[model samples]
Structure formats: structure tokens, C-alpha cells
Target: MNILLSGWQALVDYLTIARVISLIIAFFLSGAISTFMSKGAVMKYFGPNAKKYISYAIASVSGAILAVCSCSVLPMFASIRKKGAGIGPAVTFLFAGPAINVLAIIFTFKLIGTEIGFARVTSAIVLSIIIGLVMSILYQKGEEIDPNENMFNIQEENERTWWQNLIFFIILLAILISGVKHPILTIVFFVTLVVVLFLYFKKQELLNWCSETWILAKKIVPLFIVGVFIAGVLTAIIPETFMVKFVGNNTIGSNLIAGVFGAFMYFATLTEVPIVNSFMELGMNKGPVLALLLAGPSLSLPNMIVISKVMGIKKTLTYICLVVLLSGVVGLIMGNLVFY
Candidate 1:
């Protein structure tokens, strides 16, 4: 009975108007990326042959503006991958979107210690790049993009002007970033975006954007909701005492436990900081704390389910393993060496 209630409550909490609005904005932004952004542009920026340093750098830093949660990032991730982005850069963007969220990092610096906060930021960026490179290397054969491919033939005409598209995306990003936090400002930005759309974009383009967004929403949202409910049920049943007992020491085993636990748990946006602080007060080690921070925001149950649908089960599992392993190893290093 309690578990069922917990699941229902999770649904209730997640379906708040603010979150719903933010998610809708994300879907639209994702649609714009898929429909309006030319495939040539995507390939030039994130294709396999693009400059490695530049691609990874863009993928990592771009997350700063998104400030989204694990599940919220899926539509964008799916869009980029669907548009023929290389596995490496797409994966980097996926990890970075939630992990390196600017607002969440700021919250970490304020609520958590400066040292751990700094470690979290640096580690997430480094880990994202490393994981992306490794995945690209491992999956090279399957992901190879032929230059002559029809997908790459799609191009944007120079006459359309880049700045006009830039302003359009900027407004969409503003609405997403503002969310429901500044309802009036969000409304203003949304109205502006609508006006820009009607004036600057063709009717067919607008319809295509809506179609792409609806397709992504249909594919991801149902699984996202189910994963949230299951996570809530698991939250109700899991013993906090057990978590605390296993992660008190900074041993590799403890870090691994923390990493695995964090990977499967849901932490909405900036919530991980206060939750980790509470666990620290209850005797959690700094290493495991870092491990949790690294894994928590980037890989939730809801996140995993949606990612599996976007990529295949094999790739999804590999990605999960990589994140959990890297998080544990990094946490162990921080605890045993840096913090010590």
C-alpha cells in the first residue's frame, strides 16, 4: 500500500506544472534542433571526422546553458543522435547535459564544500570526454558515416542568415532556462519566440518542428513516467540505513556501491546536493559523496529507460557500465588520495 502511494506521489511530484512546462520547452527545442538545423551543420560540428578537441569541447560546454535533469535531456540527445551525430560527441553531450548543469554546479559550490564542488565539475567534464572518446573508439565500425551519404547531403542555404536562427534558438533556450521560475519572464520569452517563429520561419518548417517534437515526446515520455514510478517504489522500499552502512568508508567497494546506488536513483535537478549533505552528516565519506554526485544526475532509472529506447539495449548497458565504473574509480581516487 505504501509503495503504491509512493509511486503515485512520485507521479504527482513530477507532473507539477513547472516541470511539465519545462519539459514541453525542451521537446520544442529538440524539435527545432532536428528540423531546422541542417544535417551538414550537425556533421560539421559533431560528425566523426570533425576535430576531436573542438567537438568534445562544444559538447561539454554546451550543457552549461541547458540546466536540465537526466530524463529531461533525452529528447535533445535523441535528436542529435538521430541526425547522424557521432556516438562519441552525442554521448559526451548526454553525460554533460545533466552532470555539468551550470545552476546545479553553482548550487553544489554553495551547499556542498568548495573542494567537492570543484572536483565534481572538473571530474564530470573530464569523464564525459574520456567516455565519449572511448565509446567512439569501441563503436567505430558501426557508426561510420560515409561522406557521400544522403544524410550528409542536406544543407542550409547561406541566404537564410545564421543570426536569425541564432536569435530563435536563444529565445527557446531562455524560455527553457527561465522555466516556471520566472513565470512572467518565461511568458514574455515564449510570446517573443512565437512571434519570431511566425515571422522568420515558413509554415511547413513550423509544422515539421511540431511533428518532430511530438514524435520524440511519444517515444520517450511514457517510459519516462513509468521509470519514475518504479524509482519511487524502490525509494519507498530501500533502507536508508543500508545505504549509509555500505558507503561510510572510502574504500573502492564503498565507492562502487555508492556509484551503483546513485546510477539507479532519481535526483531532480539540484536536489542531489542537499541529499548528499545529509548523507555526509550521517557519516558518508567524501569519496562516496563524490561518486554519488557524479553518477546521480547523469544516470537515473528514468534516464536509463529512455536512453535504452533512443540507443539500443547493448549500447545503453555499455554506457551505464562506463558511467558507474568511472564514477566509482574517480570517487575512490578523490577519497583515498586528494581528500586524504
Candidate 2:
């Protein structure tokens, strides 16, 4: 009984810390992306008729910094697409946005080993470019739009200087680094940053920003809590030995299966880390570990429902399948080379 209680307590502590860190990272990075990187700039560089491969590279790299979850990325993706980004590049952004984000990568490294971490990053970048190229080929000659129509006209804010923005960015970075080392300190550091930023900015402006951030947090936090609870329950109920039966060794079949499962299973934003850690403790192999890391966050249940509404069922399903298959193949190949 004592041991069980201790385990439950540990789970709660970990979840609380992880959630705080994820929120801090998400809030600051999302704000920075909105402030510094204009949609117009993205369109100018990767607009229609841009070299297909170069556009793909740019889209992947840009998405890495935003580090938003799958759901949060949808609106931005839609806005960019509506504005006239080529189908290929737009899709690349969609894929890379969640897959290669800084927070996701950091969480991956922390939860899993560094080997899987690098694999996840490399696979995401390669898969993003491949997905873009294939999407481009499929949509080529289907539709085209004028670049000017697609340009984003973001209102510039003169209230905050570039130096102030830089300070916010630095504070965010420090919070992330500190959170990785000391979980509870993360909460303190993040709160400090938020308070400092608020004091520094005008009251009305700060209130507006806080309102927006809170709205996003409210939307996501409940879902996040539910996900953590589910994971904890699964950890408690499922026997590690049973899970080990399926993924004890880094077998090709196990890796592929894990990848496919990850692609299909709905992992809420930032939820994959805890769930993956649970699986690892259950004796899942490194190969399957990599597979899950690569595929989980990119596709989730809520995310699919939202995407289906936007792109319609057919295209959404097609996109989901392609991501799964590609992720599985990539994991299979990597597992064979690295683990075998």
C-alpha cells in the first residue's frame, strides 16, 4: 500500500511539473512567433512558384521555432493556406509545425534517450520534406494563386522595442532550461517572467495578451489533465510484463507496429512525453520508442476531428494515412540500421 501510494504521488508530481513547463514554453514561443515572424515574410520566401525543395526546407525550419501543438497549429495553417501558400509548402508547414518543435524535441530528449531524440528530429525533417514533395506533385496544376493576395499584413506594434522582445525570448529560454533541471523551479521562473513582462508593458496591452494566453490555456489545460490521468491509470492498470511481450526487443515488426500505432493513437499536445515514458517503463524497445516519438504528437484524436472539419473527411483521412505509413517506414529502416 505504501509503495502504491508513493507511485501515485510521484506520478502527480511529475505531471504537474511537466504541464507547467510545457505551458511556459508554449506561451512564450507562441507569442514570439506572432510578434517577430510575420506571415507575409513566410509567404514571400515560400510563396507559389518557389523552388519546391527549398520551400519545403524553409517551411520545416520555420515550424520548428513555433513549437505549437497540433490543434493550435490548425488556425495558423488555415490562415496561411487561405492567403495562397502553395499546397505543398503549406502541407509541409502543417507536418513540421508539430513534429519538429523545440519543446517537443526537448521533451523527447528528457523522457526518452538522446538516441531516440535525434532520430525523432531527423525523421521529422526528412518526412516533412518528403510529404511536401509528394503533396506538391499531387496538387501540381490543380490550383494557383497570386502572391500578393497571399501576403500577410500583420500590424506592427511600436509599443515594445526589439530589445524588450529579445529579453522576453531570453527569459523563456531560461525557464525551459531551468525546468528541465528542476521541475518546481520552472513554475516560479515562469510566473516571475509573466509578472515581469506584465509590469513592463502597458496595463491594457498586458491584460489583452494575458487574456489571449489564458483563453488558450483554458482550452488546452482540461484536455491535458484528462490525458495525464488516463496515462496514469493505464500505467497503474497495465502490467509492464504484458507490454514487454509486444515490445521487449528492437525488432523490425515491433518498431513498425509501434510506429503505426503511434500514428493512429491520439496524443494530445504535450501528452506524448508522459505516455511515452509510461511505455518505456513497460519495457518498450528503443526502436519502438523512436517510432512512438516520431509519430505520436503529429497525429491525435482531437486533432483529427478538427482537421476533418477544415479539409473535409477525405483529404484529412488521406493525410493521416500518409503520415502513418511514412512514419512507420522511416522507423523500420532506422530501427534496422541502428538497433539491429
Candidate 3:
């Protein structure tokens, strides 16, 4: 009874107005990102034949814009890979797209701590690019360019113009900001969001954005709730001494375990933030937290299965090794820098 009550109390405390608003922001922005970034654009710069520097740079940061989860990123990864994108850039985009999105980064900075949030974004982008480059090198053969392909291929007839997409992103971002800021600023941004919505997005686009947001919410929200409940139960069941014993050390094995655990366990987008935050609150080492943040959003069991089909077993293994190794190394560095 005591354990059950503790869990219930934890859940109630977790569901603050601010967090609810943040979740809404994450869901809607994720949808907006999906709607705006068409397959053609992703294919153009990230295609196999694109320049290493330009393509990898774009790939590294693209996830910040896309706002997908591990599974959601798989389809995009498959699309780019199928379109003959270089193994490196596609893989970079694959890792980056879901792991380091703007909304999640902001939420992490706000909910977790400023330092870890910054570390999460920096390590995610840097590791993604490094993994891509390493994979390309190990493979030794860049993909062949298809010169006959049209550069301006449009995947959808109903896709909005680039400016329209920009306005939509800004308006939605303002809504997110409104949720976190002072009441006066919140009111101002809300008014701006309404005006922008009325002035810019057509009726159909508005509906499409809403529908996309709903789809993401439906798929992710229930799982998020369960995760929070489980986290609460964990708080009651797992003693702080035990967590500090295993995860508090900044040793290589500790970081490796964190990376591996993150890879195998499924974290539904921003849920990783709170999950990690909860663990951190319980005295989990900062280094392992960094390791988990680096690996969790980009790799999962389902994510791995689909990746094997998309890129084959050997390549998939290479990618996984790179992610885990890089995450561990970075964790060591971060542990020394931040907490040591």
C-alpha cells in the first residue's frame, strides 16, 4: 500500500501544467517538422553523391529540425538510404533526427539541468557526424551518383511552399515558448500564434497540422504515461544506494552499460528527458546520463530490427558499435568536465 501510494503521488507531481504544455509543444512541433520537410529535400542534400562536408553537416543537425523518435526516424532513414544517400550522411541523419531536436533540447535544459541539456545537444550532433564519417571510411566505397535524377523532385502535390512552412514553424515555436515564459510573454506569443495561424496557414494546412499533432499524441502519450508511472514505481522500489553503487562511477564499464541499456530500451521521444532526469535526481552519475541521452533516442530494439533490413546486418553492427563507443568516450569526458 505504501509503495502504491508513493507511485500515485509521484505521478501526480510529475503531471504539472508546465510539463503538459511542453509535451503538447513536443507533439505539435514534431508533426509540423514532419509535414514541412519533404522527402525530396532530404534526398537532395543527403543523397549518396552529395559532398561529404555539406551533406554530413546537414545530416548532423537535421534531426534538430525533424523531431522524430527512434522508430519514426527509421522511415526517413530508409527513404534516404533507398534514394542512394551515402551510408555516412544517411546514418548521421538517422541518429541526429530523433536524438537532438530543438524541442527536446529545450525541455531537457529546462527540466533537467542546463549543463546536461547542453551536453546532450552537443554530443548528439558531434557523435552523429563522427559515426557517419567513420562508417563511410570503413565501407571504403562511396555510393554512385545517379546523374539522371531530377534535383527538384516533389514528393507531394499538396506540399506548402518553403515560406509557408517557415511561418508555421515560427508560430508553433511561439506557442511552445508561451508555455514556458512569463504570463505576459505567454499571452503575447499566444496572440501572435493566433494571428499568424489566421494570416498564413490555409484551412487545409491547419487541419493537416492538427491531424499530424493528434497522431503523434495518440501514439506517444499513452506510452509516456506508462513510462512516468514506471519511473515513479522505480523511485519507491530502487534505493538510492543501489543506483549510486552501479551507475555513479565514471568508469568505462558504467558508461558502456548506460549506452547499451539506452540502445536496447525504447524511449518515446522526449520521454527520455524525464526518465533520465528522474534517474539523475536519484544520484545516477552525470556521465552515464550523458551516455544514455546520446544513445537512447537514436537506437532501440525495434529501431535496430528495421535498420538491419534497411542497411543490412554488417553495416548495422558497425553503426551500433560506433554509437556505443562514441557515447562511452564522450560520457567519460563529460563526467570529468562537469562533475569531477
Cα lDDT for residue 39, candidate 1: 46
lDDT of candidate 2 vs native?
Answer: 0.70
Candidate 1: stretches off by over 4 Å = 1-44, 144-244
lDDT of 1: 0.78
Judged by lDDT relative to the true structure, which candidate is superior, 1 or 3?
A: 3
Overall lDDT per candidate, in order of appearance: 0.78, 0.70, 0.79
- Evaluate candidate 2 by giving its C-alpha RMSD to the native, one decimal: 4.6
Model with the higher lDDT, candidate 1 or 2: 1
Model 3 lDDT, residue 28, Cα: 75
Cα displacement (angstroms), candidate 2, residue 52, comes to: 4.0
The numbered model that scores best in lDDT is 3
**How does model 3 fare in lDDT?**
0.79
Q: After superposition, how far is residue 270 of candidate 2 from its true place, in Å?
A: 1.1
Candidate 3 TM-score to native = 0.89
Per-residue lDDT of candidate 2, residues 287-331 (tens digit): 777777767877777777867776668667777777877776777
Predicted candidate 1 versus true structure: per-residue lDDT over 1-340, tens digit per residue: 9999987886787677876776677777766766666545544566545677887887775566444456667897887677677888889989988897654675576556789989998999999999888888888668746443455344666345789989998998888778878989998998999899888888877888899889867865676567557656756776767656899888899999999989998877666765676567566899999999999989989889899998889989999999999999999998887886
Worst-scoring 10-residue span by lDDT in model 3: 145-154
Cand. 2 TM to true fold: 0.76
